[model samples]
Target: MQKLVSEMDNMVLRGEIPQAVAKFFSNSAHTKDVDGSETATKEEAIQKLTGFVGAIAKVNEISLLNSSVGQDVSMSEFRFHFQMEDGSEINWHEVIRRKWKDGQVIDETYFQN
Candidate 1:
């Protein structure tokens, strides 16, 4: 579990958005809003996140804020720092829940804050 998290950290630090999306994500991603509407699909999720993160030139750091592991679900919070083109910095926070199937992530829910 630590190894997987480390890999994710590395992916983000390297600004390898595609590899990060593929390695840590599943084909089915979903988010339910406060009104209970859901947006699903890993592709869409990746597109949205990549568009947001890709605007930056480089990622400076990824920090694990917290984690909780259940029988088949793992929940984590990560803090991401990025370096922009003009030498500005931005920080983003994400909460992710991964549902494992056969030892791999089969479904995921990611929230950006």
Candidate 2:
């Protein structure tokens, strides 16, 4: 989980969306659910993330407020902020749920507030 967040932060800093999305999901179902749709597979998740990233300008920061881990799932509360071309800031509260498989995230769900 820490590694995923760190990699995401690095991609944001570099303005690399594709790389960020690649690290965003473990499968398509995870990505589909994140988009407020039905479950998807890894490929579907990748396609969805691709579209989402294309719409956003640049991410300024991702702040994690807290995290809790269960037997197979981990939940994290975070604030995601982005910078627009006009120097405006947009903030969103997010809850990230990750499913662990062999100590790595094999699936993820992102909830926006």
> Candidate 1 lDDT, tens digit per residue, 2-112?
567557656755667556766666677564532354557767767766766667787678777887777777777888888887778978788777776555566666677
Where model 2 places Cα greater than 4 Å from the true spot, the runs are 1-29, 32-35, 83-90, 104-106
lDDT of each: 0.68, 0.64
Residue 39 displacement (Å), model 2: 4.4
lDDT of 2: 0.64
Instruction: List model 2 lDDT by residue over 1-113, tens digit each.
Output: 55655565456446564565565545433442545684456666566656755666778776667777787677777777877556667687878777766645567777888
What lDDT score is found at residue 17 in candidate 2?
46
Clash tally, candidates in order? 0, 7
